[model samples]
Target: MESKAICLGFLPPRLGFSSPHLLSRSPGSSTFATRQKFDSRQTLLWNKPQLSRGRVVCSSSNSESKPETNHSSKSNYARAELFRGKSGSVSFNGLTHQLVEESKLVSAPFQEEKGSFLWVLAPVVLISSLILPQFFLSGAIEASFKNDTVAEIVTSFCFETVFYAGLAIFLSVTDRVQRPYLDFSSKRWGLITGLRGYLTSAFLTMGLKVVVPVFAVYMTWPALGIDALIAVLPFLVGCAVQRVFEARLERRGSSCWPIVPIVFEVYRLYQVTRAATFVQRLMFMMKDAATTAEITERGVALVGLVVTLQFLAVMCLWSFITFLMRLFPSRPVEMTSPLSELLNLDLSDTKKIIAEYIWIGGSGMDIRSKARTLPGPVSDPTKLPKWNYDGSSTDQAAGDDSEVILYPQAIFKDPFRKGNNILVMCDAYTPAGDPIPTNNRNKAVKIFDHPNVKAEEPWFGIEQEYTLLKKDVKWPLGWPLGGFPGPQGPYYCAVGADKAFGRDIVDAHYKACLYSGLSIGGANGEVMPGQWEFQISPTVGIGAGDQLWVARYILERITEICGVIVSFDPKPIQGDWNGAAAHTNFSTKSMRKDGGLDLIKEAIKKLEVKHKQHIAAYGEGNERRLTGKHETADINTFSWGVANRGASVRVGRDTEKEGKGYFEDRRPSSNMDPYLVTSMIAETTIL
Candidate 1:
């Protein structure tokens, strides 16, 4: 912003330097207004120590009019007049002018394709040589295990090797050839350049496979099993050789040779495809005219892919070699183990047995029968039982009514003797039977009606029990869903009545307790104390074969006369197919048993008793299903431990204003005959 008038003295005639042009500031105040190339030329006055006289003569008359500028009286006159308010003289030397020019100078740009060929071809040779050999080796090993003919195996190996090698080689060469076409001149798309670099480098890695394997073989030649050793130790040995080679190269000061960039070029090609594309061939040519030292973005992207491929190849090869070693076995694998000695097992021996033994089932990776142990976790017992071979042949007793029915032979078989019971229990269970009529055990009473009913005014009762500090707390009693304010609060007690007990007077004193706050006194507390516990206990450890058939038969016979049934202890006995004993449609001889009919009926009665007990615990006269209010059940009271002191409880609001509560008790009131008879409908639908 400082403007000083400079004195260049007076111009000589024909020296050809016009009045210096006015320097107008540019549009952006931050930078110089205008920039022009400096025109360097020598004026006659420049070489002379004396100023020009001709240009002064022409301005003599005009200068006389301004007498204040005529200060020739003193030797310091020129210096003083140079910076006068109206005018100033500018004195510039060659050195100062040159300095000004230098301040505005710039550097040259970057290049894209100078050494792309070398960058591409080297990796091509390397990656191809490496990947092809393994493919062949894998195929040959597989064929050998399959016991293919000698000539066939040899041919397969040769063809596989050649094919993979050719593919790798072509890919490498192609990447190298295409490197020039993909340039990194424009930084906008650096990805293309990088892919070219990666593809090139990967091709070079193929050489590692060849050289490393050869070096390993040479070093371990003195070993007893050098061939086998090389096969297993190729990757480690190759890496070791590569490290030593790299170190020597570094020492020789030739580590930055162009070979790396060439290999890197191939890798860049792959990255461009998977990642992004940058710089085209045309733009690269322009950049190439300048510096070739800058790393193209494309080069970086390609190198990433190449490095990944290298590491992946090493890991895969190592795993494969380990697998091969496992198949062949090592010496003295076991020293003093009795089991190993008894089995006389070695790695090779084990592999043979596994090949012969492993079998797949209907489910993928699921093993069946004895041979089905190889693929996965243990099979579900409910879906698959072990095969049993006992009693007469399946054909011999196929028609016997007092014998076990057998499934025909198969590749795999179920292994359970006849007459086994299978009991399955899903967690929460709703009990079947009447909720009211507390002590009523009507063998033929209607499920909806009660034989005896009590009439009394509805009264809410509190259940007093010792809590955490053994302090008596009044908990609301009954089925939570049907009770007042429901069982959704943070209290262990619920109030309501047992609907199954009867329809007359509302029952009271039912307690809604969460399962977690419970202290079950029996069965190691492994099972939740609920209707399901009693339902599943009968079949818990029993198997399916003859026992199951007899149990089914007894259940069918009981259903003809009774509404519900269960069995505690069942023992099979021979009986003829007659009248009530012959109720089942099954012709299996195992089902034609005596006394099983009576035992099954008794089991049903026991379950009914347990159901009644659960109902009573909820409360007597609590009209709630099980032991709560109305027809609703509070599952939260039992499912979660929200009722105990310091327990969590949650309640939801129904804005719809509907009278029906969301919670329904898990009792027959939810639906009578939920069990025993529910499966019958599903079975009929299936049939």
Candidate 2:
């Protein structure tokens, strides 16, 4: 017999044989033998030439046993059959080789489809089971023993545990859901981080809920009955349980440990049930001791009472737990770059640093001092570092060797800072510690203490109005992007989402003023979309100026965060829109007493005489805002009338009716320096 070799090009490389092998069949035997090996390249030479009559002929067998003629069509079948055959020992060149079945080499473990029950239905069912039971049981206990202290405690504990446990289970089961991660590793603990984290946690945990109850309980423990305790207990227990679970989960090496808490929870539920039964029996006995008719009536009323208590308790507990989770949130691990560590270096320091100082001196504009570091807990306001600037820069001194010294007069808590920062309001001084001649603040102080002013007991309330402008466009900050909003209607003291803009900044400024110890009376949205007003009421003399300057400083700083520009221009926007103003309302002891309108009119008459002087001192750019087209009186003219917005001076109708009160000098522009305006008013009206 003769044999021929065939090479299959499409065979996978993993077949472990790259060379062609020999295949031979013995006479009268169904099996074939493959042996001998030759490089695949050699087979290519015979590839086109070996086939004759559509069949591959190896060698001649006996004449009676001819090679199959249809072998070409069955070539693929024959190759597949060869690979399917079981392994058998074969001898080739005195070496034994075992040919293994191809199927055995390619076998893999079967993967069964995961059930939806485990992934979705199981968690929902489990959470529902845990939460529903507690809710129902709590209602039952509260209904049966409304005034029982032990029952309250037990039910509270049970309800809180189940609710938190359900939350924990839900979180665990839904662990695959993606969550936002914070990278605190690169962030060193500092004021901003500390405050942000504290605020975030407080807001999450409904800090008011926890704090109000705790404070009320502490302050009026005797008055707060068992209800207070019941209300607080769930929040306390939920927080404790969540913390414990978190700690255990962190240290645990296996999943089995979580099951222990579950067992304890079951036991707690049983105890709650037993306590409820005991309280129910006691309540029934107490009811039985009363009249039969009263018992019947009470029984009928108890159902509604139980529902109301249950609903309130559940709402309170749920809200408490929800906020608690927010407070103590589970954060994801985050990756940060190496550069973040260097960037966040300032956060590592605990000491408060003086970042910037504000100087309000000769110039009407706010002069910002260069940022510098200062120690925390600055005990003495006098001890604060004095800043010096070129007096010429503020248009207060000749361009020579003269330098203006900023003498810190007062230190207010910096509301814009998350840490210990102080806002120092300063007066311009000379090297000799004498007040600078050009410092209006010092001038105002002198005028306030003058003998003529001291006897009048003059009080001032300044209504400061300003517009918020978008940084780049100069349009009203809250106005629509390109076009104007609805014309000057319905914006004053506006409520609702659509009508208001910049209320957040307004609110923030209001809070900042209050925190800075300024006598800020109130704030309201103004006539324009982005315009707002804040009032400083009844501040005497220079106190008004000092507080107003500080308040303006705070307002500017707050707007900086909003990326908006504050325009104190008398008419921030021209045309039909109303211009901004710091309308000064003033009253003396005589003006406040009986028959004060005549004194008010006398003051107004004097103001009319110096209208030009007051207008010049009111603010720069007063022409555009005081146009008679808007609500303001013309800049070149002066008039006074009762309850007249169009007049330069508006005496309130109440001032007219009561014959005593204050008159409003409505001519001052929004940008006017409060000190200069107040001093001028005091000098003209009182002094």
Candidate 3:
């Protein structure tokens, strides 16, 4: 193969090199002294101007010097050699200097044309030569010629002809247009510079497509097909053309382009040779180890080249294609809605938005409050909407009703004929040892073995552990437990009820069974908290579960029989900097309105059924009532006891206040024995 290496040529500046229409020249007159004066004056004038605006200030104040020819025109001569000199400029005094330093003082605008022509043309030639042959041989050229050799010859001729023709036209146009601009004497060099850049680009491209690919293929082949050729051929040609241009540019004393192809060729050749050697060795290795087929040097080289070239081509093309796609407007699609379009932003942008949202802790309280406060489809009470009678409405109501009617110490089934459906709520309850301790151990047994305490150990062992363990494992990143403090553990209570009773109740039994308390780590699990649909189920109430029910029931039965004791409000529990909840943390008022333990709901039902006027619902929340004064006094006493006597006190200021509103205490009107109070106090041991 003929080595396409061509000489780096330097064309002397087109004649009339010192003319204004070409490279600018300093005008001169006939008189030598006048020329000297003019040169000195010109230098002084230019030297005074500020260089900040990119103007070169020529200092020429001291002018009683040597030859008169050493004027402005002569100065131009000295500097001109930097750009025009083919052998690179040197000082008249003979100091060799690179052209780049000269260019810094003589500023040149950004020019793409110098290398663009080659960049474009080289790629075209190589691409056509390598890939066009495939199409012609496979189908087109075969149809044109019966002889295989003729077809090959014709295919090569046609592609080469087209490539050369394109190259010639592009080069001719660029060369003609670019000269007029680089010749700065006319102040039109800007145009030439731009044209030169464009020309350079075109030539560079063509070179990459043609020269590089051809070189690679000749050196390594069999993998030179349409896809590989189209992909890698351009870059290869570009490399080759760049090499040729840079070599030529260096000869012309221009340092704008660098020699890159030599390095590329050397690297590629090394890879190909290494691959071949590896393959020969691999064959022997595989034979001894175990092999399906023999390995060949050619095959290995081809594979290595394909893998390397394929990767480079794909990466470059993919990056360019993506950039192009981003630059262009996206195509309009039949989108469902604006919201969908907003949600479906570019993947990177979407990720950024998500990161920002998480960092800011959701859309902020303003947005949340707006969303919470926004009234949905509000219906007039009198003008009952169709949904008011719909079965779905009943389904929705069925979920919540179970907690109110069945759970938390409500009416039970007839124990004689039908198994009494026991509902219990244990206070600070646990299975074995009391998690929340008391002074007298007897009180724990009394609470646990109470008459209405239904199934023994119902509010047993730690229930929160099961839920918490499952929660922590399921969402490792999201719900971690290491944040809480040991001093103040949040007491989570489960509300549970049983109903082996009438038809209406039994029908609701299926709904109640949904809270199976299955482990939540996997598929079989309780629905997560804050899910309104599941929590409000008829069988499952607010804070509903087996242990919670037993705890609450124990507290309630204790209150009814032994009188008011203590009260808790869990919701307003504020954590300190160390993350421990404050004492007297439980508050129903601060509980999440979404689905929290509704003490009023429990108190109302119990009092209403008991028909006791001492404890009446009167909060105006649908006329809900309670033994308000007595309950308050009991809670105050419990607080005082916790502070002073430590929860063991039975009566007095550290206990319940005997007043009119004290619902559990005997009324002044109703006479009661002192021994009765003492006996009830003695029964605390049963707990």
Candidate 4:
């Protein structure tokens, strides 16, 4: 931001450190951008320098540590007049200008070529990348394992693993903004420059460099190699993604397909696991080697060195690749310069933050959120400032007078933005400071605050089940359109891809909920294919509502990214398929005490009398799902029995036998409002 040009004075190399230094900085389109070749002319300016950390340390007898910016009065006059109000430092300007030109040449403007002659080489490259390393490493692995089958499997797995891991590394570069090479990348609708040369180089060299341990493992022991390989499997499965993805990008030049973006999600997941994989692989290998006990001192040293080297190698590779990107981006990566990263840096420095205020829409089933910057970090809800939104936009008010106030009730870590940022759970009120009609949390709050309700200390664990449907057709994810699968007999907690559909979305949602600080217990495939369930645990008071709503919101975000639809319609399909349920697990302080089975029994009696009233508030369209058949109690009746899924309220056999523990309320449908459901349970049983 300085206005004047700075004079360049040379510095002599420092003692002890004589290697050439790298001065990395972003330089393109922000000003005097250049696209001229970096061939040989500018290389002279960077021929000499010393490196330390950020500062360039130079040795001096009399002197020589001066930077290239101090000026003489005579030169200062010329610099001030000639390059005024523009960047003119020798290294920053010279390096960026040349790098930009080189990047353009390397990542040439893509041309859409269907079945282009270049693809014939892709297969050849892919095969060679996978086969050649295994072919060379096989002899060593064959000696260690002695079994030809295990040797071949281990050897080939190593090559493939390295290749897949490298895919993730390649993407890390492409997804970031580099200085001279790329400033901003405009995405093509369908066409893409898939991996370019890095696809081949990454497989051949990076696999050899960072994943060098793959070869060293064979000499140590048998299972050590396999387990170490397994540790990197997160990267393997997460990034093996790109092999198919790159092929598709090449094959479908300029053509659009929805699945590409979904598969690209692997990159995000892979990044999260990248740092952890090394540690996991180390533990696995150490455990395996120590058990075998055929280890020599040399093997011990080698194993330690290998793991350490590999860990350092991966870290260095990341730093080198990222630094290399900003400098000589010979290959243009299609990165959307996230301007937020600049602001994010400021956020980290200042500790000021973004708070995403989330509220339920007028439809009650819908969740809404908006973000605002706050002055600084805040923990207490009372300390956070109140904000407003246009109520008419969310159907909570008429346009004539539409502002709705958002009162912060709870705050959770913002999983998406991360750092010190937070996700605030809020409820709406009118400008006149009255709770809006759709503010169920407010009513739940009043009930929870009651002295009797507070004394009971209610806990609710809601099992929320929902079906995933194809975005376009609105049919269950794996079910045929206008048709059905054989039956739901084997789909309950099914393992195979055929029976368990949308596991990725489900898993993503589960992790997102946990990362957002929600009390998410666990998740599993449901009895119905394309359906899954996640539990919002043992949370107390109105927090049960707060967590479930946020968890649901997280699922909505993840499903949206996956281009899938989440159906909370109680029963998405007619007939024999099992319906989704919110299945509230309730317990009071008394119910968890010794000899509390009698107390639980008394609470069930209260629940049975108010079954109809609770059902109406449980969810919309409950009659469609609560039909006596399909693991559901009939809507018109209230029944209670031990371990009875079909009963309106089921007491666990353990609870009956141990004379303590929680009872399950089997009536609420998947679409039930947790605020209403949890509070009502307390109101009837304890209050």
Query: Whole-model Cα lDDT per candidate?
Result: 0.24, 0.59, 0.25, 0.62
Over all chains combined, what TM-score does candidate 4 have? 0.54
lDDT of 2 at 435: 77
> Across residues 508-617, which tens digit of lDDT does each residue of candidate 4 receive?
88888888889999999999888899998899999999999888888887776555678887877666788889999999999899988999989999988887789889
lDDT of model number 3:
0.25
Question: Which candidate leads the pack in lDDT?
Answer: 4
lDDT of 1 by residue, 260-297 (tens): 22332333233222211111322343454553433343
* Candidates 1 and 3, the one with greater lDDT: 3
Better of 2 and 3 by lDDT: 2
Q: Report the candidate with higher lDDT, 1 versus 2.
A: 2
Tell me how far the alpha carbon of residue 449 in candidate 1 is from the true structure, in angstroms, after superposition. 16
| Candidate 1 global Cα RMSD | 39.4
TM-score of each: 0.15, 0.49, 0.19, 0.54
Write down the worst ten-residue block by lDDT for model 3. 355-364
Candidate 1, overall lDDT?
0.24
Candidate 3 accuracy as TM-score: 0.19
Q: RMSD, model 2, all Cα superposed? A: 31.9
